[model samples]
Target: MDSTQELIAQGMKQSVPWVRTAGIEFTEISDGRVVATLPDVAEQRNHVGGPHAAVMFGLGETATGAVVLAAFSDVLDRAVPLVVSAEVRFTKLALGPLRAEAVLGRPAEEVLAELDAGTRPEFPVHVTISNAEGVTTGELTVRWTLRPNR
Candidate 1:
């Protein structure tokens, strides 16, 4: 229930209505960190009887972007964030409930400066998705751009 977590929860509630509908739950949010969980159900499975890749990618990217957005919010006023690029790698087929976590890296100062200068800053965020056994099932790198709202 820290400031960043509060902001993330509020923003998710306001912006991503589908998250609630899909039963995606944000479990943690801290400084430059975020985690979300999604339950495994038949509806989310692919024709091959495994969790859909898009579902896994979506959860990872969204969770990672949320963390980056929260971090950038601390630097800029009226800043809007968007994902500019993303890459996902499936290390293993997800067969059960999934957990995704995003962790921030360096370049904090540069990102802040770009935000203050009204230049969109791109942050590279790493996301790891794990299955019920706590083994990593997938990884994603999402690039987010932040800019001031005109």
Candidate 2:
């Protein structure tokens, strides 16, 4: 129900060139949560006929980025957002047409307060990748930061 999906997707496509070629679709986005999916095409599949691990990682990254953008929509022009790190675990064999859900792990207002105080703030975004049937396949935690623009 979030209207910023289009703008975030466009910005992602331009900023992360791989997104354009990755075939990721932004399905839903909200204040601090987002859902994205990968098509069941050959390019996104692995040797076992499942979604490739890297593709799944991409989904996690993209979905987390969407939530970051949505949560910090009010401070866009004053900062530069970046993913500082990511730790992902592939727990199961993922199927095609996979979906990834990402949620911000910290409060937006808290992070904003730190940024407002001239301190670059970092937060975690947790992502869960699942199959069409709602079975989770992987979990990823991406640490993101909003750096104050000089």
Candidate 3:
């Protein structure tokens, strides 16, 4: 795995215990975007044999949080990202393996600048969760804050 993926995996392994059970695997991580996958597993299925809504929401949050953290990874010694609120919508039943892509509205440079200036900035990350058939099954808007780690 690459450095970004390794860092994501390490974070999940060390702190986010629930993400592992949900099968949230980091696929891509960049300055302003992150992608993850939630495998279609029997353990995660609902009574109707489809992926549960919670799985998508959890993966969405995880994906968005990963991107925000990756965007601020360089300043870990001074600041950290925290999810203040999350709004999620379940559009349809997510079937098959699900993939979630989270995009940051602001570029990484702008975000880092805010942190460098010792300002707590909040940004919204939009996440779209799709199934193997490429149908959007859910959406998440996560508001994260970059603040000094106190």
Q: What lDDT does each candidate get?
A: 0.81, 0.89, 0.84
Best by lDDT: 2
For model 2, residues 26-67, the per-residue Cα lDDT tens digits are 878888888888888786788999988888898899999889
Q: Whose TM-score is greatest here? A: 2
Q: List the residue pairs that clash in candidate 1.
A: none
The list of candidate 2 runs beyond 4 A from truth reads: none
Of the two candidates 1 and 3, the one with more favorable lDDT, higher being better, is 3
Clashes of 3: 0
Q: What's the lDDT for residue 25 in model 1?
A: 81
lDDT of 3 at 118: 74
Q: 8 in model 2: Cα distance from truth in Å?
A: 2.2
Candidate 1, residue 24: the lDDT equals: 80
Alpha-carbon lDDT of model 3: 0.84
Sort all candidates by lDDT, best to worst: 2, 3, 1
- Of 1 and 3, the candidate ranking higher by TM-score: 3
How accurate locally is residue 113 in candidate 3, as Cα lDDT from 0 to 100? 80
Model 1 misplacement above 4 A: none
